[model samples]
Target: MELGLAGRRALVTGAGKGIGRSTVQALCAAGVRVVAVSRTQADLDSLVSECSGVEPVCVDLADWEATERALSSVGPVDLLVNNAGVALLQPFLEVTKEAYDMSFDVNLRAVIQVSQIVAKSMIARGVPGAIVNVSSQASQRALANHGVYCSTKGALDMLTKVMALELGPHKIRVNAVNPTVVMTLMGKANWSDPQKAKVLLDRIPLGKFAEVENVVDAILFLLSDRSGMTTGSALPVEGGFLAT
Candidate 1:
């Protein structure tokens, strides 16, 4: 189970909370140097308090110029996790331009922009780095009031494939970890109601949602040499939701 990720520096977006925070902690435990990026300064402070050596950067990924400026100087990231994303749930008929723009900016556009920076560095330094995009099962299956969110993730999966295709020659593997609802604090609160949760829970053959650790484990595997043969793949940690 050794990921062989020790000593490799990684940059993880949306490191303030949920899966991003857990991923940072896992990487730090594996002896990987981490660059944690989140817009909220307080979250960054708290994360560093917990993990100690995390290099925290406060920047909103939705801002094109700001993201570039913040990441331009991080200096040769050996691993990249494009985990910063927003879920602006809206019915297909009610989807607005603002929601669409913000969702696309953070979910898809920022991924391309960030990866461009990291992949360039990897190629230049001859680093056979890996990139893990945090996509969702919502990309494959439709959810009520998640039209815009689904579109962004669907695009993200395609982007992951194309990135892997081009970056494979450089030994820069790009893949996505598509998870179902991970049981973060917020997720638990949202799904605590059995009647509401049953609607989706019944669809999952495993009859359970995933935990942050579940998704994190998958991500580390993909980022490590253990998954060296995996590239341009969207590995699902969705607890058999996709199967049913």
Candidate 2:
């Protein structure tokens, strides 16, 4: 179970809270030096306080130009976890242009931009690295009232493949971990309503939502040398929700 992650430098976006935060803690526990990114300075400060060997960087991923500039100052990264994403659950007809744009900007475009920058550095340094994108089951299954979110995740899944192909020659692996509902702050905020929660839980064969640890475990595996041959793969940590 040695992840061989000690002394490794990792960058995880959306690491202030939720699954991203959990992943940052897990990596740090494995002895990785982590650069955590989020939009809120308070949340980033909280994360840095809770975890040792973690450097918090506050930047809005939705703003690609700003993100690129901010990341350039951080230098080379050994592992890049593209975990920042936003979900909007509304009827397709009601989804505004702004909402759709925001969803795409944060979930899909930002991933591409950050990964591009990090992968370039990895290649320049000749360091074999891994990029793990935190996607969702919505990428494969179309859920009611999640049209825009689904679209962005679907794009991310494909982008993972494209990145793998492009980075293969440089020995950089690109993959994605797709999870079903997880008990994170975001999950609680969106699914706290009894009716909505029930509707989501009923679809999972496991009869329960995933814990943040569940997804983090999968992501850590993919980021480790043990999964050296894994790339262009979308591994599902969905609690059999997709199976049902």
Candidate 3:
């Protein structure tokens, strides 16, 4: 599974932990230089200690000015992963403006902001690249108390399609990996309860949730030449949850 991605430079958002962290390690192992972006300095510091060739960038993706200033000078990136997101869960009736804005800010708006910066660099340099938007199964399926989160992800899916249509001509592939409740820090905090976990697990044909590595594997494939022909795809890493 050598994706022929060695020596490439990649920028990964939300690299503090979970799937983003794992993806950084995987890319580094494959010989790619990585710029790890996270809001937390401690997470970025810890990541650099474990992975070589990592350039850590700490910026809150939700901050328009800070995000632009930090990533606008990122130079040329052959690959980009828009994995940073926030899940402000609230029942549909209970959803507040604050939750709506925060979810949209980190989940969708920051994606557009970061991708525009990276994609523009790629276009200017005439470099063929890949962009992976870390969407969610909630994008296509309804989940209680996830009104705002689901809306952002659904918009992200459409955004991926539009990016492929527009950026494809420039040879920049854009796609999304829609994963079911991955056992990330957020996932464990929400689903560690047996009663809650079983409610969703039973719907999945595989009767389980995904692990960080499971989603990271999909991200790497989409970023690599292995998926050269793949663009505008919403690859599901949900272990049959959406199927059932």
lDDT of 2 by residue, 66-130 (tens): 99889997987999999998887789889999999999999999998999889889989998999
Query: Backbone clashes in each candidate structure, one number apiece?
Result: 0, 0, 0
Candidate scoring better on TM-score of 2 and 3:
3
Which runs of model 3 end up more than 4 angstroms from their true locations?
none
Clashing residue pairs, candidate 2? none
Which is better, 1 or 2, measured by TM-score?
1
**Tens-digit lDDT string for candidate 3 (1-244):** 7788899999999999998999999999999999999999999999999997799999998899999899878877999999999988888999898889889999999999999999999999998999999999999999989888899999999999999999999999999999999998878998989998999988999888999999999999999989999999999999898887
Instruction: Provide the RMSD of all predictions against the true structure, rounded to 1 decimal.
Output: 0.8, 1.1, 0.8
Score residue 184 of candidate 3 by CA lDDT.
83
Error of 3 at 55 (Å): 0.4
lDDT score of residue 103 within candidate 2: 97
lDDT of 3: 0.94
Q: Which wins on lDDT, candidate 2 or candidate 3?
A: 3
Candidate 2: Cα lDDT at 119: 88
